[model samples]
Target: MRNLQGRLELCSINTATLGHREPLNQTIERIARAGFGGIAPWRREVEGGDVPRLARQIKALGLSVTGYCRSTYLPAATSAEFSANVEANRAALRDAAVLGAQCFVLVVGGLVPGSRDLEGARSQVVDGISMLLETARECGVPLALEPLHPMYAAKRAVVNTIAQALSICETVDPDRSGFIGIAVDVYHCWWDPELTASIATTGQANRILAYHVCDWLHETNDMLLDRGMMGDGVIDLPAVRSCVERAGYNGLVEVEIFSAQNWWQREPDEVLAICAERLQTVC
Candidate 1:
């Protein structure tokens, strides 16, 4: 595994870690001054400011767009809703292109509203991705499908495993043209029994697009907002990083935490400093 002792250049922070309490422009400046190499800003954060100016500012500050946070959920109750969601994704992809992002992340949403058929929802996900590949390919932005934890299987994401995300890729980008891939997040995937082998397989296919770090707390109060920092929870983060590196993913290792009660309630700079410190020492 690679030693990241002083390599802040290899680290990135998903702006959501700052709790979205501030505008992205200021957030960008603080993150750059904090010595991170990249920032993954969410769509809402980007929309609050001018993309053209934001793009210029980020470039001037010398930060890579690790990724555009996500695609709108692909599954919906009706054909029209699904089509609208696709158009929204196309627009998001265009914005991602404007930022020169490394990839456009996809959360491949859960079962459609008012439905319980998991297989049907997965179909919508595959078809939605197939349709969006045109825009993604045109923009030259790879789509990084992110599988949420199984608990999110009903409301956030139906694709709950790396294997499932890879299966979607097989159906959509069979040629491996680099247009489709998976975004691995420890919070969502640490429970998978086949993660190490899946990471190896993802490397063999060159489909691992992003690696996210956050710990899963054992006694979580809220599943969506209770993620822990590195070394604060039960996850074996260093071991996971080794597997990811061995699988050939040498890109930025992003920190994405959603701690509503703890970190989010603290000062942003302190969070960023802790993130940098943890990435270097623990992660």
Candidate 2:
């Protein structure tokens, strides 16, 4: 496994860790100044803004866009809604290209709006990715299927395991042209019994796109928030990273925490400093 050893350049920060408290440009600046090598910005952060200029700015600061945070929900209630969602994802891919992102992260949506068809929603997800593969290929941005934890299966994502994401990749991009892959977020995947084997399979296929880190609090009060910082929760992060490394994933180790009551309340600089510190130590 790669050692961070105080090497901030080997790490990235998803802006949500700071709760989206500042403008995206300012956040990018702060992240670069803090010595992180990359930033993963939410799409909402770029809406109605100067994308090309911002991309240039991020480049000038020497920070790469690790991945664009997330695709629009694929399993909507209506055909028009699903088409619109696909279009939105296409737009996101275009922007990711302009920003020179390494990959465009896909948080495939769960059960369709107002329905209980789990398998149906998953079908939509696969179809949506198939529809977007051409755009992703054209834009030169890989579609990274980030499987949210199963708890999010009802709303956020239907693909909740590395194996599931990999299966989707094989189905959509069987030749593995690098247009589709998986983002392994520890918070979501740490509990899978097939974690190691599934990840190893992904590695053999070269489908691991990004690796996210955040501790799952033992008695979390909120599902969305309450993410523990490195070493604060019970997850053995090092073990997860080892599995990821053994899978041949050599990308930035991204820190993605949603601590509404704790880290979000602190100064962004403080939060960043701690992230860097923990990346060198606990994580």
State the RMSD for candidate 2: 0.8
Task: Please give the clash total of every predicted structure, in order.
Answer: 0, 0
CA RMSD of all predictions: 0.8, 0.8
Q: Identify the runs in model 2 with alpha carbons over 4 angstroms from their true place.
A: none
**Model 2: per-residue lDDT, tens digit, 1-283?**
8989968899999999999999998999999999999999988898689999999999999998999988999998888999999999999999999989999999988897689999989999999999999999999999999988889999899999889889989999989899899999999999999999999999999999999998988888888899999988889999989999998999999999999899999999999999999999987
Lowest-sum lDDT 10-residue window in model 1: 45-54
lDDT of each: 0.92, 0.92
Q: In model 2, where is the ten-residue run with the lowest total lDDT?
A: 107-116
TM-score of 1: 0.98
lDDT string for model 1 (1-283, tens) is 8888899989999999999999899999999999999999999988646898999999999999999998899898889999999999999999999998999999988887789899999999999999999889999999999988899999989999999889889888889989999999999999899999988998889999999998888888898999999878899999999999999999999999999999999999999999999999889
Q: Kindly report which residue stretches of model 1 are placed more than 4 angstroms away from their true locations once superposed.
A: none
